[model samples]
Structures are given as structure tokens and as C-alpha cells.
Target: MPISRLSDLSDRALAPRLVIKVGSALLVGKEGARRRWLTALVAEIAEARARGQDVIVVSSGAIALGAATLGLEKGGRGSLADAQAAAAVGQIALSGLWAELLGSHGLTAAQMLLTLDDLEDRRRYLNVTATLTRLLDAGAVPVINENDSVATQEIRFGDNDRLAARVAQAAQASAVLLLSDIDGLYDRHPKEPGAQMIPVVEGVTREVHAMASTESNSGMGSGGMVSKLQAAEIAELAGICLVIGNGQHERPVARIIGEGIGTLFLPRRSASARKAWLGGRLRLKGSIHVDAGAAVALRRGSSLLAKGVTGVEGHFDRGDPVAIVDAEARVVAHGLSEYHAGECAAIRGLHSSEQAEVLGYSPRSSVVHRDQLVLK
Candidate 1:
């Protein structure tokens, strides 16, 4: 069902694991950090935690804050080196502020700086997920930011909007809240005379994407309506609801959940269906060929063990999705490999007990764990 009005958001739907993306424009100002806005936002987060909802914040402002601190200008004129230096300096300030603000509310905050490699590499992806889960379990809010200090333009996500959507998927979040300069998506640019606010978007159709303005509204932020729409599409594919609203208001988080003052993008699939969709979208990076007995074991719901006598067929990194083929060369399943191709080549046909001795260290016994595998 589409949510065309504020009344459509119920308390039951509101209480879920939420990933909130805060833009640089809302969090930074001329002098420095916007303390008043952050204080209120932290209070809202604390209130949500009290209501038994786990919240993760994906924030953007390190570059802006750093640039402000160094008296450097914002925008395209800044060099890559300048941006990196600024991020290094600004991240400390950003994390420190979050810690202090949340501390006052009796909540602990954990800082996590991530690069694209962290999510794309299988081992690092699992590690990150585990760490975030542990932090949430321990009643701490995770404050995440892109590792801009080390990331190059070629590998960077560029905007936190897409990063937040990926984080929501990784954390298995039920909802995502994007706090932007504007209140919600509009049928046309809100500045236009006849533009209309769209309260609910069932899906990100081409029409919805076309509604986004080409130019960003905030000079401090990199993402515009187009990026938010892209994020909404990603969230929708993950079966996670996304809300885009104005962060300039007092108690913005509270208003979003309580009053539903935003454009809500409804999820089109269930969690299981979403997973299946993801499996389908992955391009096969490699293929692992298994013997008949191993194929039968796989069909019987066993994890793909190294002893299964697999032949690695391509160069791929750990966490890259690969096809699993039987003796007949028929593709039977697809999954994220626990080890890279070279590691698999060294340990193939080895017993679980011998994995540590062969590899010098055993990260895991299964080459492809059942949880990561999807049967055809």
C-alpha cells in the first residue's frame, strides 16, 4: 500500500532497525559544527533507542568541517590532497562531537570509518557487519563515515546517500531516513510555482527519478535530489523503506517518525525476496566446479566445504559472487566465496582439520557458507 498521508505511518512500522543519513549541509555551518541541531538530533536518537529501536547514523561533514577549520573554500576548487587533509582533521571533530552529545544522553557512540573495499571484500564485509551488530547489541550507536582520507575519486562513493543505502542493506535495516535540505520529493522543483509535494512513492519509476532536480540545493553537500532518488531505489530493492525529509526543523527525527513529515518510499519485496533479487543481480566473478558427491551434499543443505574437491575457474577476490557448478558443468548455485581464488586453489580437496595447517591460518572451514549461498 502507498502512504499518501502522515497517518499511514504506524508506531509498529516506525519501530525497526533504522539507518539515518545526515547531510553535510544540515550538520555544518560557517563557524563550525551546528551544535544546536546536533544536540536535538542526538536526543531524538536517544528517545528512539529507549523505544527499543536500533539506529545507525551515516553522516557527511568531515570535508566541509575540515575545510571550514582550515579556512579553505568549499567546492570544486579544492585539490584532492586538501580534501584528504581536511577529512583527517574533520573526522576527529565530528566523532568527538557525536560522542559528547550522545554521552550526555547516557548513550555510547562508536566511530566507524569505511572505504569501498571494506564492503566489497568478503572477509572485511563480515567483519564490519559483526562489529556493527556487536555495538548495537551493547546498546551503542554507531557513527559511520566514509574513509575519505584514503579513498581516491575513482573508488569513492562520492556521496553518503548511496553509502547509507548500502549500509542499510548490510545491517539488514528495516527502514532508512534521509534528512535533506528539503522536506520531501516533489513532482517538480519545489521552487517552481506549480510543483507538488509527493507524500509517498511506491517505487522509483523513471518518472520519479526524472522529478529530481539536476542541481544540488546545498552548496555544502554533494548529493541532490537525483542521489536521494537513487538511494530510494537501492533501499526499495533491499525491501527497506526510505523517508526523505527536511532536517532543518526542530526535532527532525522525532517529527519524521511521529508525524511522518516526509516522502516515504515503500518497499516492494519481502526480506527473502530481496535477498533473491540481490543474488540475481550479482555478475558471476568466477565459478567453482564440484564433484558429484559435493553437489549432492550441497543439495542436502550443507555448506560448501574445501574437501568437496572444487576446481577454481577464475581470478576473484573473497566476497565476490561466484557460480557453483556440478560435475556435469551445470550451474547449481551461486554464493559469495569465503576465500579468494588463490587461497581456494591451495586448499581445495583438503579436510577441514587440515585447512589451518595448509593456509597457515583458517578464517573459516567452509569455502562458501550456506547463509551466503543461494540454490538454483
Candidate 2:
């Protein structure tokens, strides 16, 4: 089969569904300035819609623009209260701009704000999916962003890159386009001598780690190459094709989908809702220390057996986040707990079948089922 170019793909039948993530850097420009890209972006989306492509846009600009409007100079890490205030200011301004631009293009844009809890909880996750599906079905473009205005540190998505990946997974998109200021991932910063462009990344590793600089290059975004790579890894695991490229060029979205101007990361073998949830859901809240044999079994993708658990620490209930730790107390993976810490302690050394005798009430046999566990 012949290789398909980005332009070819764009001009071809639009994908069944696509998640377009526009970074703050592109939306806010340099020094937290707004640009004309929104107009062009709306045009491209309109074109895609005309071609029968269902598109959901995950946009970042609230914090950047909010800081600028407030004369804060930059959107640095600030107190939670302060950041929330900035987001409140920015979200209002950002959504207004999107509504105006998209309206001019004869497209309606609906703002959907989300927090980590909404994506992590199974019911809420499905609800979000249903709403986006309805919006697309109604010929509306769902404009998604992290619920920064009201999200606390405990429930925040932290960054838009991660938020986009989760949204892509939830929407079950066929492709995710990550638009940034930089063209693509490079072996070294292009500004430096002898830097080479990497067109395709199969998977992220230390080798590829050298290809990305550790810091953010965007003046208006907190995301850097590292975060993009991490986001790609998450999206790939969710079986979604991820493309990274620049949004500054004329028709960059069209070019990235059509001409192939950026780096493309292929999806993994397969991804399930459970697996994607495990990998992208709740942050590790505590550690469950297990013996060596259990650690080896977990590495082999087996479920956590009660006999392997040595001790449990911290507070976590059923469906709460917890880490699977080795005897040496190193985190090997993270997953949702089947039981609380006290319950787990009572049954730590018991066999799976003997759970009822130990805990008085038995839930599932495995402490953390393989499907609910994501290895680090």
C-alpha cells in the first residue's frame, strides 16, 4: 500500500470523528496576545463539517488571556484561589471570542468545562460522551476545556494536553490533532545547530525523550514538548492516532491532516474503556505494598491476588485511587481499590476464595483487576 500524506488524508473523506486541540500558545500568540487563528480555525472546522466529519475542539486560552486582561504579565503557577480567579476571567473572554468567530462561520459553539472527577467517574464519563455526541449530531461544535474556574487542585486535570487525551478517549475519536507553535518533535531544538525533525514516533522512550526539550517553549501555554509527548502516549494507549504540529502556519490544521507536516504517533495494539480509564483516570492516592511474587505477576499483566498483599496504607475506598507497590515500597502501578484500607489489611494474607471469611462481606476476588491496573 502507498503511504498517505497529510494533505491527502485531509482532502479525502473526513475522518468519522476528530478531536482538535488548540494549545494556548497558538491561541494567545506571543506574550499572551490573541491572534486571527481562531477565524481560520473556525473556517477549517466548518469545512470539515461540510465534509461530514464530526469534530470536537479542545481549546486552551483562558488562563493566558485572563492573565493578560488582568495585567498579570504571565500565567505562572499561583495560589489555587488566584488561578481560579484568572480562569474565571479568561474563560468568559475566551468563550465570547469563540462564539463570535464560530457564529460568523455559521457554526454554533457550546462550551463544555470538565474536571478530573467528571472524566474519572464512570457515570459522569458516559454522561459527557453522550452530551458531546448529541452536540455533534445537532450540527454543533463542542468547545471543551478544563474546568479551571471551579476545579480545585484535587480534582484538576492539571493541563490541557492531558485533558485533550481524556476527551479524545471519551469521545472515541479516530484521530487527535494537537496544534502548537512548534512544527513537530525534533531530535534537538530546531533553533540549535544540526537539529533533525522526527516525522514518526512509534512509542515514547528515553531515546525519544532526548528528542523533546524539558521546558515549555510557548509564551502563553504551560504545556511543553514533554507534556505533548506524554499526551500522545495517553492518546495512543486509548487507540487514537495523535498528530503534533504547528498552528501558526496558514491552514495548518488542513495541512497537518492533508500534507503531513508534523510528527504522528501510532496507537497501541488495542485499548479498552477499562484500560483507558485505568491509565488516564484518578491520580494515585496511596500505596498498597505487595510481596515480590505479586509484583512479578502484576508485571505479567495479572490481577492483584490478596495473598500477595503485605500491607495497605492511607485512606482509599472502593473505586478510589491507589498505587500497587512492591515489597521495597516502590510504585509499580496504580489502580482503583476493590476495598478500603482497613478491609484490605484484614484480608491481606488470605486466599481469594477466603475473602468472605476474613472481611465478613466479599466483593471481587482480585484487589485490583488487570483491566483496572495501569503499569508505570
Candidate 3:
């Protein structure tokens, strides 16, 4: 069902797992932390927890916080090394403050710093998701941030908005709320006269993207409205609803959730559809050719066991997506490989129990698990 009203969202039945993103501008000030705003935000989080919803926060502010602590001039372009050093210093203070503030509300906060590699690698992605799931189950609110200290331009996510979207996908969250400086997406730049707010977005069309082109002037944050729209697209494709709203007001989260004072992006696909989209989105790194019997087994929803694999083509690492082909060279499915191409080649046509003898140690019985496979 398409959610067109805020009343649909306030039901709580619609969103069980929620991921909220807080930009640096909302969390930091010229002097230091924004205590009153932080308190209200944490209070809202506590209220949500009391209502039995699992909430995760994706926060950004390390660089800005670090720069302030080091007495570095703000709004100045700095080198990558300088930014990294600031992040290293800021992460400690940022996480500490999060812990302290959440603690005051009697909620435990678990800090998680992640890099792009963590999500791109299947094994690492699973590990991160599992850890987050465990933390939520233990009643701990996981506060995640990008690992800016070690990230280079080539490896960084660039903004917490996209990171939050990826986290929503990995955690299988129901919704993602991006709290920024503006109340919501506007048809024109909000500062411009005659700008109109877009209350609901059923899908992120090219037209919707045009509204976000105005670069954000928020001194403490890197992302503008463009990044939030990008995140909305990601979240929508992952079967998660996304909301972009202002965080400067008291009880900002509550206002967004209860009053729906933001631009809401609805999920257009179902969970299975989203998974199929993901399976098809990645470029195939290699091919695993299987025998006739194995192909039939696959059709019957069986895992791709090592004994069934006849050949491994291309050099690819574990967790890389690979096409599963039949002997006729027809691709049947695609999935993340459990072993490197070289290791898979060595284990081809061997029984599951014989894997240890062939490779000295076997990581998994199946080359590609059924759960990971998406049939054409």
C-alpha cells in the first residue's frame, strides 16, 4: 500500500525498524554541543524505545567537532590529511558525548564506525548487520558513523546520508529519517521566494532530484539536499520509506513522525522485489558452471554445493557476485561467492566432506547458498 499521509506513518505498525540520520549542523554549535536539542532528540529516542521500536542513529559531526576542539578555522578548505586528523580527534569526543547524552535518558549507546568496504564486502556486510541486530536485541541503540579517520576520497561514502541508506538496507529497516537543516524538500530553493514544500513523494523521479541541487550552506555539514534525495532513492529501492525533515526544532523527531512535517518517500517495491533488484544490480565478477543435476537441484531451491560445480571462470575474490551458469552456458542465477575463484577451482567436483582435504580448510559447504541466489 502506498503511504500518502502522515496518519499512515503514526500507526507504528508500519515501521518496526527505523534508522535516523543526524547531520553535523544539528548536533554541533559554535561554542560546542547543542545540549537542549540533544536532550529532546534523546528523549524522543527513549520514547520510541518505550513504544517497542528498534531505532538506530547514523550521525555526522566528527570532522567539524574535531576542528572546533583543535581551534582550527571553520569554513576553510583543508587537505585530506588535515581532515583525517580532525576526524581521529573528533570521533572520540563525538562518541563520548553520544554515550553521555543517551545515558542520561537511561539508554545504552553502542558506537559503530564503518567504512565503505564494510558494506561492499558480503561477509563484512553480514557481520555488521548481525552485530547491529544483536545490539538492538540487547536494548542498546547503535550510533553509527562513517570511519572518516581512515577513509580516503576513493573509499569514503562522502556523506552520512548515503551511509544511512546503506545501513537501512543492511539492517532491513522499515524506514529512514534524515534530519537536516530544512523542513523538507521544496519545489524551488526554500530561500527563494515562492518556494513550495513537497509533502509526499511516491517515487524519486528526475524532477524530484532537481529540487536538491541547491548546495547546503550549513557550516558544520558536508551534504546538501542533493545527498538526501540520493539517499531517498537508495532507501526506496531497498523497500524502506525515507523522510527528510528539519532537526533544529525541539522534538524534531516527534514532529516528523507524528505531524509528518517533512517530505516522505514511499517504498515502491516489496522486500523480495528489492532483493531481486540488488541481485541484478551488481556486475558479475565471475561465472560458476554447474552440471545438469546441480542445475535441477538449484531449480528445486537447493544450495550450490562444491560437488556440483564443474568449472570456475575469472579471477574473483570471496563475496564478489558471480553468475551461476549451467553446462549449456546459460546463466540461471547470480549470487555472492563464498570462496575466492582459485579456492573454488580447487574444490570443484569435490564432496563437502572432502573440502578440508582438498583445500586444507573449508569455509563453507556450499559455494553459493540458496538464500543468496536470485533466479532469473
Candidate 4:
């Protein structure tokens, strides 16, 4: 395909759900969190939220901020120990800033720290997705970062770019905007004379990979241009549009989409790789007790329908993780509950057709979807 122009985007529409990745290089400065930029970015996000669009931010900078707080060199992960300490110190400040910034726009911010293990483990990935769904349902913006303090090369994602892609896959988002210092992919080292910018990429080829600069332009960030391409590949496989854009502007997302000031990687026309039997671990808040017949049904990989539940234990709200136990109160499985403890109690043993009358709302047929359950 030929290069796309800004005029081509005039009549275009963006995806309903968008995931934005903000690298540490763009978010942190000598003073710590760049409030001015963050304020600008969050303001735009608040506006999008107001317009009824869902947005999730995958951010980096905890370790950088922690290093700054500890008076260490900026972005200096001199040793594994040093990086972990910096992340521990920085996460507190990062979370606080995220809360304060989004709160100004009357938006609640929830923090999620993840590692590669969180995404790869069959039991934990589901929990993360469920939590994200819950937060979005509550109209809160989730600020996610790698759990750097506890992350090691063996378990860590290593960079936010690819993590953002994983998040988009789990969220089933339509678009991913990778905000960076540079505008987008280029034909050669941008500094080289006559180097040209590529406006749109339909595929990732060896030729495309060769275009990536070997060195990270931003000395502070772990993700270089290469990682952005890697992220694009992931997004493409999931049928999610990925854009690499300069985020220094007031409303970078708008500029990227509207002005064509970024490189847009088109997703495959058909995306089937996005679907998989995902696993995850989430904080457990309650338990659901079921009859022996229901236990047998669940053991056969059936969903926990409302009619099977004998009782609910503890006080878990919607989207909270709960144990599914048998008559002996032995845990059969762990899964996210579709309804709150009260709701589950109110509808226990009731058929799906009978739930709306008792609950005053149409209830999910299954208290726990089979896909969300992990058999013990």
C-alpha cells in the first residue's frame, strides 16, 4: 500500500476502546513525573471518557522515578537490586501522581502492577482481565505498570510496549497508541540526510525490521524502536490497530489519528490468534457453595449457573474472585464471580428465568463463566 495521508483520515473513525502506552522517557524528567505533560494527557483521556470511549493507560516510569527519589542516576538500573529498590520507591509516587492527575478530571484511577508471568500463567491472566473489566465498568481509568519491584528477567515483561499489546489483546481493544518522543517509523536513521517517514505499515517484514534503529533514541527507556515493531506485530495478530506517534503535543492521540502524524500499522483483516484459553490469579474475596450435582457439572467443565449455587460465603462484590466449593466445602475451582455476594445469595438456586423478578434486574445466567474458572 502507498503512504496514507492526513486527508485519508478526515472521514475515518477511531476504535471505541483505545489502549495508550506512555513510555518512561516521555513521562519522567529531572523533576520526577512531568505533571504538565501528564496533566495534558490525562485531560485528553478524561475528555475521551466523557465522550463514552474506554481508555486504558499502560505507563512506565516507576523505577525511573524511584531512582530519582533515591538520588540515583535517572533510568540507571545499575544492578538488579538497585532497579528493584527504585521501582518499590517509585511506584508509590507514580500511583499518587496518576490518582491526583486523573482525579482532577473527576476520573478515578486504579493501579495494576503486572509481570510477564501475570500474562502467561493460565490462572492469573483471567484475573487481570476480570479486574480490568470491573474497573472499566466502574468508569475508572486503569494505570498499569510492570511489577518491577518483584520482576526479574525470567518473569518480567522487560518493557511496556509489548505489555501494552498484551493488555490490548486481553481488553479486546480496537486500537493501541504507543506514545513516544519520535513521530513514527522512518525509512532510515531519522538524522540521516533525506531519511523519509513511513505513514502506514500493512505488514512487518525483514525490510521493516531493518528500518528500526539499533539504539534506543531515548536513553532512559528500555523500549527502542524495535520493541514498538514487536508490539505492532502482537497487535496485528490480535486485529488491533497500532500507532507509533509523537506525544509531546497537547492532544497527541487526536493529532495522530486526525493529522496522520504517526505511523499506523494496519491490523490483519481477519484476526483469530487473539482467542485462547487464558489463565490468571486474582485476590479471592468469597466462596460459592454448590450441591453435589452442581459440583459434578462443574467438574465436567460446565459453567456455575445460578441454579447450582447452594450458598454464598463472605462479602464479595461483582467481578471479585471467589472459590467454587462442593457440599463438603472443598474448593472445586477458583473463578471471578459475575454477581456480588448479596446478589448471588439473593438468586442462589433460582433458575435464570426466575432471577429478574427477585433481583429486579436481569442477572447473568452463570455465577461463574466456565472460561473464567480454573479447576483445582
Candidate 5:
């Protein structure tokens, strides 16, 4: 219980499941070339697998790789589209390196590109979880990245750190390892004269935020200390521990796992699996109207019954996203509807058992099952 430093925290005592995020700054250096750091990082992951650990890597390097390939890499501000094009070019090169390196270690690597919406919609969220789980079960490592090619300004995760945190929550990992160019957070910028290293942090209090800086290190990546903290907040709320460390060190992943060479973040109370899936994975498309009594029932941990639904307002299908609201029109929860708009209209005020008689064919017992309903 006397945790003094990150290295003191035993890997055996920690969560066995993990989500590791490597930033672009660590993947490539300022000269617009691949860094030796990635070789060591992949070695660490292979070693972790040797010890029977489940690992999912959320990595950022496509844009950096793309820029290097084109020989037009520069350290300057550019348009979002320019960066996106770099990502498109880099993703191919990045995957090639990942596949080759991981394959050498006798491990298979699968590439997964995701955006914010994948984790926001209930159905798609479940699908993603299922795919990741299957890959893990088959003893293959999944390398995840943001779908920068098609992702618009509004839907992008903004940075891979935040995307990693969401992926950690979705996979219900025990911990999230954020590897970057910097070794750890500092009391001030590492370049500052009086800057001191504070090793272990418990929560996102004012003291923690004070350590964050907005300085960017890589032209290929957009995150800084601020974005890392934002990602940590999300992972912490999901009961996923995080460690921010330098990727330049040889076997950095192994050092963090066995030797603990990073700034460790403790987790808060863990969210339920269903709630985690709902919060981390599902995307909402529309809203449904409910009575005041139904809202109260939902808040009190009850299923969304037919008597509670006042009206269906969305142009969604049976499995389309919809929100459950109260008489005052406040959103109570979000879930996929069992009945479509026309079907819901036909049995708006009917009881659960009467759904079959009214619709002539019941898709599900509850209009929205408790499993599908996520409380706001």
C-alpha cells in the first residue's frame, strides 16, 4: 500500500490486461526518420506476451511515416488536409513496419483504425469489442490507430492519446501505458532550470494540471502534456491505470511493466462492463420521449418499459440509435430501439406483454432492454 514511485508498483499486483499507446514523437525523430525506439518498444511487447499478458497497442505514427516516405517532411504548421494526407501515406508504411517487427518476434499483428463514433454507438461499440476480444483470444496483438483518412474535423479523436484511452475503456484493460518522446511529466517544462520530477500521481487535482504544458514536440502529432492529461482523465474514470513514459529507452515497455520507468496514474472506482461499453463505445443518433414516471424509474435502475414511453420522434430503424427522455424532455438514457418509428407508434401506451398483440410480431420484450439502456 505504500506506493512511493512507479517502479515500486509490481506488475503482478497490477491489472493483467493493458492498453499501450505510443505517440508519433517517439516513433520518429526530428530528422523525419524512424527511431530505434520502436524496435525496443516492440521487443518489450513481445516479452510481455511471453509472460502471458494480454496487450493492445494504440499507436500513432502514420503521418510521420507518410511524411518521411514523400521526402517532404518538415517541422512546421500545415493545413489539416495536408496532415491527413500525410497520415494516409504514413499508415501504409507504419503497418508494414509493425507487421515485420512483430512478425519477427513470433507474434501476429492486426491493424484497426477507429474514430470517435465507433465508441459512441451501442451496436458498433459491441462489434468493435467483439473483434478486439476475438483477436486477443487468438493470441494476436491488435495495433490501433485513428482513421485519419476519412475522419472529418468534427469526428476525429483529435489525438491518439485520447483515442487510446477510449480503446482502453472499451477493452476493459487493467492499465494504459502512454509512451511518448518525454520521459514523464515535470513540475515545469523539462527545459526550465528549477523543473523537478514528481514521480507518482493519485488523481487529476489542481497540482496535476499545473504540471501540464502545451508545447508540441512532433510535427506529425498534435498532442502535448495537455492532451495526455485529458486522455488520463478518461482512462482514470474507467478504472484504468495509466503510465506516461519515454519511448526512447531500450525495452521501454518491459521497463514499465517489470521495472516501472514512468509516471503512474492510479485509477478511480471501476465502471460496470455494460456502462463502460455504453460510455466508451456507443454513438447516439436520435431521442425518444418518455413520461416523468419512466424517467424516475430509469434513474432508480429500472428497465425502460412501454408505459414510460410517450412518443418516438426519431427517423431511426429498429436497431438505430435513440435517446430516452422524460415528460419534461430531459434525456434519461440512450439505447438501440427494438421497434421502429411506425411500430413504436402503434404500441406507444401498451404494456410489455401486450407488445406482441399490438405489433403482431415482437422483436424483443422491452422496447429498450436494460442491457441496451445506458443512463446519462
Candidate 6:
């Protein structure tokens, strides 16, 4: 991918659906919820739906609203317990607001609060994906937010930018529009002299990351430019285009689609939802190293077998994400392991016919099925 101008989303049949991320700052301010802006935003969403586009909103105002109601605030953050309590309180208010606004346009709202595990664990990830597809089928716009009430640091996404990207991948959205306070990433901080906004980012490079990371979020928002870039990576892996733009304008989304008033990140594209998930997610528990023959087999779309296994490194249970590396330590692919690390270790280099005797039970023949693997 190379940097270029934002394409006309309307003029192109780019994707069947879209995921829009609304930051906490965009949704709430010093006084209260920014209902007027939200109303306009959803109106555009309704307009998109009118054009036969499925839309999902990954919003981030629960903690801000909840914190204000409870009178405990650290720019919309508090102790984990307090934040959780605030989310429990604010989510109801948030849902009610979404209901009223979307209903006014004859659109229904469905609330979904998810934590990292919801997208990290394969089974739960599939469930979330199915539910999202069903919600769209029912003509309801799903308003999603991170499950702050029960999530700990250990399993949290830490920012909605990445969360929104994950949602886009899960929903197989055509594109993602991240509504940020600033118009888009600049050559430098917008404050410095001669700072010009970069309209399109072909890819997130190390230099690009350092350029925007100096800036910080305001009010209750948590994500800054760096997180948005992180989101960009996820979008690229999913082969979904992403845009970061200022949402503080009238019919902001419309202008973004019509005039391209932001930075657009292009993508390479995904083969399927399953491959996207397997390739895009960040957490990997361990690695399975194989010989050159195994690597060739995998490239030819063969499932990983015990006969090719050399060794296993790291602690992982079945269904965990593990890197499949060749003898030279180059990662050739990523996959969900059929057997636990221990089971895999025990059956290494053994024939399928002899595996049951070693393990004392019948196991799946393939260590990593072709369907579960995504080549790098």
C-alpha cells in the first residue's frame, strides 16, 4: 500500500458495512452529553442505512457519563472499581440516548458491551461476530462499547481506537471511520509552525508513529494518535480501509464521505472473516517450529501434522494463537492449535496411527488445520 488521497466511499462499492468509532471526548464534554452532535451523527448513519449500508457504532462515553453522575472523576477515569461502577450507571443513560436518537430516524439501537476476551477467545469472538451479523440482519444499529464495569487491565483493550478496529474486523466491515477531535494526523503537532495535515496514510511506519505520538487526548478520551495508528494496523490486516477525521462538524460523516476531510488509511484486503481474525489479532501464546518440508506443505495449503513438528515453545492450551515458524525461525503463518502445547510436544514426529497410543486417546489428526492457519 502507498499513501494517497481519500477515495469516495459513496462512489465505490468498497464495503457492505462500516464501523464508526466515537471517542469519549466527542460524546461528552464539560457540561454533559453532546446530544446535538450525536443526533446529527446518527442521522448520517441512518442515511448510510438508507443507501443499503450496514453501520455499527463503537462509542466511548459510558465511563464519562457514569463518572459525572457519581461525582468521581479523573477526566472520566477513576479507580478500576469506581470506573466499573460509573460504567454500570452510564451505560443505561448511553443506551437510552442512542435509542431516542436512532429511533427518531426510524432506526433501532442494540447495545453491546464487550471486553478484550470477547474478541480474543475464538469461541467468544465467533459469538460476537454472529450476533453482530444478526443485529444487522434485523435492521438494528449496534452501539458497542468496552465492558469497563467488569474488565481489568489484564484483559482490556485500553483504548477504543483499537477496540473499534477489532470490531470492524469481527463485523467484516468495509471501512472504519474513527471520529477524532483533530482533523487527522499532521506532519507534526498541529500547534507547531508550518504543520500540515497528511490526508492519506498508506501504512503506519515507525517514523509515522513517532511523528504523531507526541500529542495527547483531552477531557475523557483515552486514545491519541499512536493508538489510532495501532488501529490502522488492525484494519490493514483485516483488509479494511480506515479514516481518522474531525467529527466536530455538521454532518461530519457526510462531509468525510463526500469531501474526504481527513486521513484515510488504505489496506491490502482480507480473504475471509476467519483469516482476518486469525491474522489480525495481537495476542499469541506460543510458537510451533517446523522443518522446511512442513513450511512448504503449509504454503501448499496442507494442515500441520505431527510428522513435521520439531518443538513447541511457550505455554498454551488448545485454541490458542501460536506462530508457525520454519527451522530458520522465520514465522510462516499463524494458527489456532488443535492440541495443547503439552499434547503437541508429546506427539512430535509421531505418525497419526501411533499418536493415540502415546496420548492414550484419539486426538484430532491435524495439529493445526488448514482452515485455522493464515499465511504471513
Better of 3 and 6 by lDDT: 6
Stretches of model 6 off by over 4 angstroms after superposition:
1-7, 287-314, 323-333, 337-372
Q: Per-residue CA lDDT of candidate 1, range 178-198, in tens?
A: 999898999999999999888
Count the clashes in each prediction.
0, 6, 0, 10, 8, 0
Candidate 5 C-alpha lDDT tens digits along 1-376: 4234555333534555678888787777766545466777788788778767788999887877776766653622155776678778878888878888899999999999998888776567778888998999999899999988778777878788888888888786777888887877888898999987666778666578888998866545788989888777767667777788877677776666466667887765455766655544324556678888878888887777777778877677887767788887666776778878888777887886887888787646777877776665
Of candidates 4 and 3, the better by lDDT: 3
Error of 1 at 318 (Å): 13
Give, for candidate 6, the lowest lDDT window spanning 10 residues: 1-10
Lowest lDDT 10-residue stretch of candidate 5: 1-10
Worst 10 residues of 2 by lDDT: 1-10
lDDT over C-alpha atoms for residue 52 of model 5: 73
Evaluated against the true structure, the overall lDDT of model 1 is: 0.81
Among all windows of 10 consecutive residues in model 4, the one with the lowest summed lDDT is 273-282
Question: Which candidate leads in TM-score?
Answer: 2
Report the alpha-carbon TM-score of model 6 versus the true structure: 0.80
Cα distance off (Å), candidate 3, residue 61:
1.0
TM-score on alpha carbons, each prediction: 0.72, 0.86, 0.74, 0.70, 0.71, 0.80
lDDT of 2 by residue, 105-165 (tens): 7989999999988988888989998998889889888999998888998888777887888
Q: What is the lDDT of residue 317 in candidate 2?
A: 83
Better of 2 and 4 by lDDT: 4
Off by over 4 Å in 3: 1-4, 7-10, 75-77, 271-376
Better of 1 and 4 by TM-score: 1
lDDT, residue 118, model 5: 84
Q: Which RMSD values do the candidates have, in order?
A: 8.6, 3.3, 7.9, 13.3, 6.3, 4.4
Return the lDDT, model 4, position 230: 79
Tens digits of lDDT, candidate 3, 64-88: 8888887767622287887888889
**Model 1 TM-score relative to the real fold:** 0.72
> How are the candidates ranked when ordered by TM-score, highest leading?
2, 6, 3, 1, 5, 4
lDDT of each: 0.81, 0.79, 0.82, 0.81, 0.75, 0.86
